[model samples]
Target: MKIVTIFVMMMHITGSLCAQVLQDIKLNAPDMERGLTIMKAFGKRASATSFSSKDLSLQDLSDLLWASAGVNRPENGKRTAPTAVNAQDIDVYVLMKSGAYLYDAKTHSLKGVIAGDNRKMVSERQTNFANAPVMLVMVSDISRFRGDDTEQKLIWAAMDAGIVSQNIGIFCAGTGMVTRPRASMDTEGLKKLLVLSGTQYPLLNNLVGYPNE
Candidate 1:
């Protein structure tokens, strides 16, 4: 009877922990009026050398993801960043201290992927970058592209990923935030952590935060 009681309590504790870790985040609408002008953002755009550890506000995070690759044209379901053949191959995974989430462009929200801090996998050898409050890891699912040539599909994936990363850079530059696009990360570890399929490849990542001033 005592053993049975202890097992039940342990199961209850595990269930509570799972609930805390896998909570989905419904993002807010993007603030259309915010940020600097296109020219100003272009001028200010530069790679950040350091980042603050402070977490971003819900609004800022919402805007950031929307700008990254959210659906800009609601009428046709088009996105801010264009992909080759409109494949929409790139997927942005948001890694924070709390958990990892996949940005659902159609719904403009974050779908919880896994629980616990996985930023270390994105930071990899650049341990310093782990301090950034948020990390956006870009993964491309080549299977989305309708092509027989695997090599050409991979090329398109790279280009599409770069476009999304650039959007992230410009948004940060204009919005008084800091970010740096990088190719360094534990790809194999991320694949296992995120449970990525064989067709999905993590190509790039961006460390995002306020300047450590």
Candidate 2:
């Protein structure tokens, strides 16, 4: 029954696939050396550069994604972000030319979300996610928090996710990369592109890329 169910799901995915499908990339970033450097270099907005044409190799992409929100140490499920009550309510969805992926911190890699260059839908920035090699969308899941007061719980999740988002900024600065986090995204457009479900919603978007200047 399980195998049959899986087969049916696969068929469904293959039927409605888009272009520029994502390849199952190999997870092979050695460690956080560059990541750590990025953390320091861009710590608290030291400077900002225009990243227009810098290209990132597979390994570089792997490393950046890991540092953005990937888990550094094992033993505990704790990630680079601080969660309110450890709710971990936020999900970081990475949009790129290849496709979109959900960052798997524990494994320090990406898991495919969908096939195609859905970056444009996530943001109205530029050509082919130009200058910015990586674009991170921070999403909050209300179910992750526990509180009778609706507003308070959501506020907590948003604040917590902000902390994680800033860490990405620092990482970018450390790596000579440029990034801008904005909530001014095309929400409706992103929902369609990401294939969001009943409980998911796009909260914030960050543009990360090599500076052109």
Candidate 3:
């Protein structure tokens, strides 16, 4: 009886830990002027090959997300990146070493989507993106569009996500961090794993990490 009781207790403890939701993280505010200078300085984009194995801290993740698409104007919920018609519907699904999370720009939090290190899933043959410290999967909900035009939906989604991707690239460039953006990803696999709605489309993948220096 004692053994059974101990076993049950262990299961309960495990369940509790598994269910813990990571709270919102406070980000170190970015220097916008510096970022703009870096953006203008990058004459052309480049793909970084090597990366450090260090795990990104919560603060680091928060800063990256904030720079990518966090609310710049809390008074009206305006984001760092613009959306078509201000629909503000793109979701940045983060693939990290600990698990998967959906970045909530409004709350500056990472909403837990699944609990496991699925980072390798985002990598492709062109580059082992899994080695990078972080990857942001840009997903757009087609239903968020103001109209039912399919082509228009794709166009807007790509354009808006491109802006965020450039934000990330510029941030990396300024910080001496390495990065690469890829449009060719295993979108179908990710959709199934993420259980995305039919209208949701994974548009781009952005990889970021410290240079292997």
lDDT of each: 0.94, 0.71, 0.79
Ranking by TM-score: 1, 3, 2
Looking at model 2, which ten-residue stretch has the lowest summed lDDT? 42-51
Q: Count backbone overlaps in model 3.
A: 0
**What tens-digit string does per-residue lDDT give for candidate 3 at 1-213?**
999999999999999886654444445564454443654538544677777878776656767788889999999999989999997868999887767888888778887777676667688665555688788999998788887898988899899888989878877776566678888778888898788999999999888888788
Q: What TM-score do all the candidates reach, one by one?
A: 0.94, 0.78, 0.84
User: Candidate 1 at residue 182, lDDT?
Assistant: 98
Worst 10 residues of 3 by lDDT: 32-41
Could you give candidate 2's per-residue lDDT for residues 73-157 as a string of tens digits? 6677777777888887778888877778887776667778787666666557544444466778988777777767778877886
Q: Per-prediction count of colliding residue pairs?
A: 0, 11, 0
True-structure RMSD for candidate 2: 6.3
Q: List ranges where model 2 is wrong by over 4 Å.
A: 1-21, 35-49, 125-131
The TM-score that candidate 3 achieves is 0.84
